[model samples]
Target: MSEEANQIVQINSSEFSWNKKDGVFHFDGAPALLFWDNAFKIFLSTIMEISGPDASNAVFETTGFRMGLLVNDYYQNRFTIEEVIKKYSEIYSSAGWGNVTITSLYKY
Candidate 1:
């Protein structure tokens, strides 16, 4: 595995917290929610059931693009560009989303 993949494999428990009274979980000081893969599947399925495959896919794609932009703005404001690039994948992986490797990065 690549170094990035290896980095993703390591999990630091101290980076996570739970507020039992509020039923909230936090990672790296940001509030988080857990959703099983099955729940995500059901979410897409429900959208497909209502809107059909193409529409559902489009909806998700566009929403994902916009959400990514918002996340980018948040990071850009708080971190240097280099820091954002370095920490982006690790942050998402730490959140239990999945590992992301930037194979060929190009800076403008």
Candidate 2:
């Protein structure tokens, strides 16, 4: 990973408490609702190994589906995947991960 990718990974990892044994992410020390943006980042990290033409599509679909179950469903559809992507793009950019994008999340 590049330094920026490493930084993103670090930021994302610090946001949650992980249960390595169970492969779970917890908020406030509990398995509570994760924000949609956070869920998107987590799912995006998993597909870092993916590449080629459909990479963005893969990231979009996978992140959307996971967010639907982990965050959106619990909040009753307050936001969309597009919104999450746009919001996080700015966040990642400002955090020195400017290369990170909805499309680039999986492509790299």
Candidate 3:
């Protein structure tokens, strides 16, 4: 990543808070959880095994779309459109979703 991209994706540790007693984590005061990718893959594969690929795809797509809308609403309140565009990768990366590179952006 370029230096600028690195800066853009930098996350501050202070944004995350842990509540040991409650067994919960929060990022920017919003509840969050961290899980290994392998574990998630196993869970997904199990779903596929039970439901089949077609059903699992529909299930995943519906869940993802709803979750994405919620995420967009959350960020929309906290950031301007431009800020959201620039910080999209940073938000996901900080949430442990993996690095995202916006190689190209287009506006309609």
Ranking of all predicted structures according to TM-score, beginning with the best and ending with the worst: 3, 1, 2
Best by TM-score: 3
- Which lDDT tens digits does candidate 2 get at residues 46-73? 6664564389677778877997687545
Worst 10 residues of 3 by lDDT: 1-10
Candidate 2 residue 81 Cα shift, in angstroms, is: 16
lDDT per residue for candidate 3 within 1-108, as digits (tens), equals: 233322122264327766655566677667777879999999999999999989999999999999989877877788886777677677667888777877666767
**What residue pairs clash in candidate 3, if any at all?**
none
Q: lDDT per prediction? A: 0.71, 0.52, 0.73
Q: Which stretches of candidate 3 lie over 4 Å from their true place?
A: 1-10, 103-108
Candidate 1 lDDT over residue span 20-44, tens digit each: 6556666555666788999988988
Deviation of model 2 at 69, angstroms = 3.5
Can you give the TM-score per candidate against the true fold? Answer: 0.72, 0.26, 0.77
